[model samples]
Target: MTLEYLDYTIVFLSLGSSIAIGVYYGFFNKSKTSEDYMFGNRQMKVLPIAISLVASQINPLTIIGFPSEIFVFGITFGFHFIGMIFVVLILIYLIIPIFYENNITNCYDYIEKRFDRRTMIFLKTLFFILGYLYIPVYSYISSQALSFVTTGINVHLINTIVCSICVMYTMLGGLKAVVWTDVLQNFVMFFALLFITYIGVTEVGSFKETFSRASDIGIFEVNTNLDITSKNTIWNCFLSGVLLFTCLIGFNQSCVQRIVSLPTIKDSRKAIILFFIGFIITVSIVCILAVVMAAFFNDCDPLKSGEINQSDNILSYFVQKLSINTRGIQGMYMACVVCASLSTISANINSLSCTLYKDCIKPFIPNSKNNNLIPKIIALLSGVFLICSGFVVEILNSTAIQIITTSLNLVFSTYASTFMLGFLAPRIHSRAMFLSNIVGFIVILGVIVKGQFFSGRVQYEPIEKTFSTDC
Candidate 1:
């Protein structure tokens, strides 16, 4: 069969498998109670939680766009993960203390307890916004992957279809099913990474050959200067990455819900440790894969050739190259891409649903503690609304995507300072906590906006963006 036929076959096969899995999860593992739905009945094992963490973090962007970053930038960007290690440490020592101390159901619960009713409501509302808004980035990634393996399909159209599939399953099964499905996706993820790594190494000859090629292209660099102005520098990585990841992992409802899955706080701690190990391994594998792709395609630059304008297109380009050389590998490659996209989107939907139920709808529902239907209804509605929001994003010509992505990133970032002030600083009144968070949120948002909009005028080169304009 021709490569085009094989590509079509792959998408068809993937869609079939996705539907089958969703149906099985929906029917067999339906949630019987709020605890069962929200926290997997609080009986989660360490391995599943670990796998879920990896699944949550390894979005299609990380799989597709990240390797592209490594290819275009260099191994220096590995420092981002390095700082992530320290961020996990911060979570363990700093953030987890409050979580364990308070026996919190949602991360935002801490804000309500430490601050006031207004603060709690506001913060939870903020997270609801953050969660719903972030859906499009996953949609964008899925659409891009679909485009890679299909012909004559619009990317936005593919995104909406994929988003609908995800919302349908998540709305049907709730969080437990999502976690169970994540375990399977995590394995698919590992297999996918290993497959790409194998193909890349074989294409480049060997490990030594791959490293030699990467070195020839100047892909490895270890710089010690801690300058915020220098992108990917160790110092800037320490500052920005610590802040970024603390919010991403510690504060994110997606990550929080997973950690709270275990039976006890101690088990939660164990899951966090396992998550750190899995996170390191998963990130390291992706980095190695990125290097492999760079070496294998050392002479090709699609942007330079005007084949594509964005770094995100690199994975499709590489996959097409592999399809030309092998039989059916392209099919497996596309399956991996779809699995990555589906897993992350599934987790996001699950978490978003949980937040809406616990923080938004539950408070209003009379005797919500006794009536579990409220949570289920809220979860279902949240998924439906977010899918609509995804379509709205598609219509707005990309602004919806930007707002969703940036709002979540900034909201998650404040999680670090919010949790720190609440847990670490003693004698902080609810008034103080409220005032500090408001002040900090405004200040941080201003800084980020100024940096993004007036970056050319200020000429302040952040460590992560130092090399962004080089090409």
Candidate 2:
């Protein structure tokens, strides 16, 4: 069930290609200023930016997260797409125009102009908190995937190496390198899903057979019960989806950074539209793939049978089960997982560096203004922070999707009302908004602390997934 040399070769080639991209951009397409390093001088290609957005949105945590989630919770996540549509609309017509009109590169930078340094710093702190909580989860997931590929491998070593590779290219190549490598890694993601799906469906007999098995598992049912207290109901998913997607997609620095990277407002809007389209397609495929995995594992549950350590690693377990007949499939899946992590890791690290320099460091030192090397060095340092923080994820008991949703929920509670009121309600006093922001952050931070340590992890009841060892 182990990967052969062919698989290792494929994985290494992917890793090597990503580094090569960094070298090319770092040397040939060098950024002359910090602005160019961050946003490609606002003259970057539109399509690559669009694809990179998709990659960052659907990184490795998601590649495995969706299937694990679907295997247990069904398609509740899909209902969130409805709210996401509206979020995209707001980003395109309403929010993006403000950033574009103001010539704002760092999203937090806009806060300083509209309000004050204090308000900007408050929002910036929330952004940093979100990044620190979630980015490491992605790195943890990537390392777990590699460890699954080669059983008994050192998890920390895998995490360190893979994260280092991603950070190296990010620091060397800048945003252009990140985007182009994303284009490459995104392709790897698509191919991995395709290969697994085709094989899985074939093994399950046919597409029709697979769907029937998924239905038999009861995950195919759409719970339309309209109750806020309910977990998997369509009604709950819709409301939570809108709220959460707004925080994750609308306000997240990673998404905003990509949108601002393009030149014109028109281009930025077009890229957002393209990103929406790409996301829907990619998510549709992931959902379908999850169903396929569910169908294949319908009878003998990997979790119940002890075939995988966790549901998050189920996709890797399934791949290993299929490895007897395949040689290089493990490598392909590994590459896909690695690519997913790299896309988000690099994007957020890049975004993190910008916020650190612009909001955190530069304001204090005023002398570091407009310096390119400082940002690059900050990016490199952020990479170290990402690696160290990522290891902390080992202590969490929930799956990737659960962890992400929980963190985003807390973050939304902290910054959403304040952030929106800041831009949408110009007549509102900045002091009032800042006060609300402080109260919201303190309340949510308390909830997070109590839930994680004192009380218990706050979560809704989930549908019972019928898992058994006996077929």
Q: Estimate each model's TM-score.
A: 0.88, 0.93
- Candidate 1, superposed: residue stretches over 4 Å from native: 1-22, 223-226, 367-405, 455-471
Give Cα distance to truth, residue 371, candidate 1, Å.
4.9
TM-score, model 2 to reference: 0.93
Clashes of each: 3, 0
What C-alpha lDDT values do all the predictions have?
0.71, 0.80
lDDT by residue (1-471, candidate 2, tens digit) is 756889989889999999999999889878877777877878887899989988887787678877777776787767876677988887887788888888877667777787778887877877788887888888888888789779888888888898899888898888889899999998888888888878888888999999988888877778887665466778877777777767676677777877788878888878888888988887788888888888888888777777666778888888887777766888888888989989889988888887677666676875564576777898888778877876678876766766877777877766567667777898987787788778877888787677667435445544555644575
lDDT for position 177 in model 1: 62
Predicted model with the maximum TM-score? 2
lDDT score for residue 345 of model 2: 91
Error of 2 at 168 (Å): 0.8
Model 1: which residue pairs collide?
Answer: 226-235, 230-463, 231-463
Q: What is the lDDT of residue 290 in candidate 1?
A: 78
